[model samples]
Target chain A: MVPISYYLILSGILFACGVIGFLIKRNIITIFMSIELMLNGVNLSFVAFAAQWHHLSGQVFVFFVMVVAAAEASVGLAIIIAVFRTRETLNIDQVNLLKL
Target chain B: MLHLVLFLVFGAICVAGAVNLLAQNHPISSALSLVVVMASLAVEYLLLGAEFVAAVQVIVYAGAVMVLFVFVIMLLNAGAEERTQGSRVALVLGIPGVLAGGLLVAWVLVQRTNTPEVPLGALPGFPKTIGALLFHQFLLPFEVTSILVLIAIMGAVVLASRPEPKMKVPEKES
Candidate 1:
């Protein structure tokens, strides 16, 4: 059996990549994708720990996270569409009308 | 040995896909990379014995969520964003800092001595067990999530739909 640490390490790497992507990416969609990546990373760790502890709760929580992610994606994309309609761009810098 | 190999392979694939997602100029390419990441993560979940979450990952994330992303990209006719001059400090220091932080966390986790040995062949996340838990232990949250999804659907429709044009007032006779 693979050590749980390996899974945790991989999850950490994926999460860091997601954070870097979120920081560097200019497009809102890509930023959102990065967020999803981060969520996936966390889910992986949750499952790993679930396996470690012999509990089903982590997997169940991961399910809930997926559901929330789906809901967030729909609403977020709709908001993105609305922003594009009004602003004519998906660049985060350009969508700063709300910034004072 | 085989399990470790599979984990490494899928983990590598997922990381590469995430990097591609960051590097891609076009949203479509990024979305595709994200799909790859999701698919590979599903495989990882399977390897970890969470068959149900693995299936859910593929179906919801790769299938539905990615489709939504692609549809929005197409609908908006989104083009590649022009590269803006990012701050030099962020470019040079921020990335390494985040990576180091992650490494530190991983190291800390690995250093912990009391991690229990996971038994082989225990399928805690099998669909039957998950379903039972979801309905019996997590019924309220599950039902709430359905409602949340319904609200999201309504919100999307309302937000994306075009507002009707206001009728012009008739001019009074001079």
Candidate 2:
């Protein structure tokens, strides 16, 4: 049986990668995907703790997170479409209509 | 032994996929890389005995969310973003900052090794157990989430629908 620390460390690495991606990626969709990557990393740690503590609540939380992620994805994509329709680009820098 | 090997393999896959996701210029490619990452994480969930989570991770994340991403990319006719000159400030500070944060978390996790080892042969996350808990204990939150999904659907429809021409003249006149 592998130690829980291994899972935690892996989660940390994935999450850091997500953060870096989020920072560097210019495309809004890719940025959103990085957010999902971070969420997945968090989910991994949650399941690890659930196993470590011999409880199921952590997994339940994961379930909720997944649900919310799905909802967010749908709405976010729609907004992205609307933005593209108006601005004609998915580049975050170009979509600066709101910039004062 | 086998568990450790599986973990290493899947963990490597996940990290590699994440890096590829960052490196890819095209959103579709990044989306595919994210699918790889999600699939690997689903395997990790299975390793932790959360079969239902593993299934959901594959179905909802790798499957549905990624498909939605691809669809949006296609609909938008998105091209690879033209790389601008690198931002010196982000390069100078951001990489080290992220790396330091990750290393610090890893170090802290390594220091706290007193967590009880997962019992061998124990099935802690059987679907039945999770289902029972979901319905019996977490029912309200679950129902609320369903409503949230419904609202999201409606919101998406409203946002993405073509704007009526009546609003165009007001904006143009301004």
| Maximum-TM-score candidate | 2
DockQ of 1: 0.69
lDDT of 1 by residue, B50-135 (tens): 98998999998999999999988888888986899765677788878887887789679868845654544445477888999999
* Candidate 1 residue runs with Cα over 4 Å from true position: B87-100, B113-121, B168-174
Q: Summing lDDT over every window of 10 consecutive residues in candidate 1 chain B, give the lowest-scoring window.
A: B113-122
How would you encode candidate 2's per-residue C-alpha lDDT over B1-174 as one tens digit per residue? Answer: 788888889999999999999999999999999999999998888888889999989999988999999999988888997786546666889888988887788678768977665543234588898999999999999999999999999999999998887644445554
- Report the TM-score of candidate 2, chain B only: 0.84
Candidate 2 residue lDDT tens string, A1-100? 8888888888988898888987888889998998999998899989988887778999999999999999999999999888888887878767767832
TM-score of chain B of each: 0.84, 0.84
Give the true-contact fraction for every prediction, in order: 0.72, 0.79
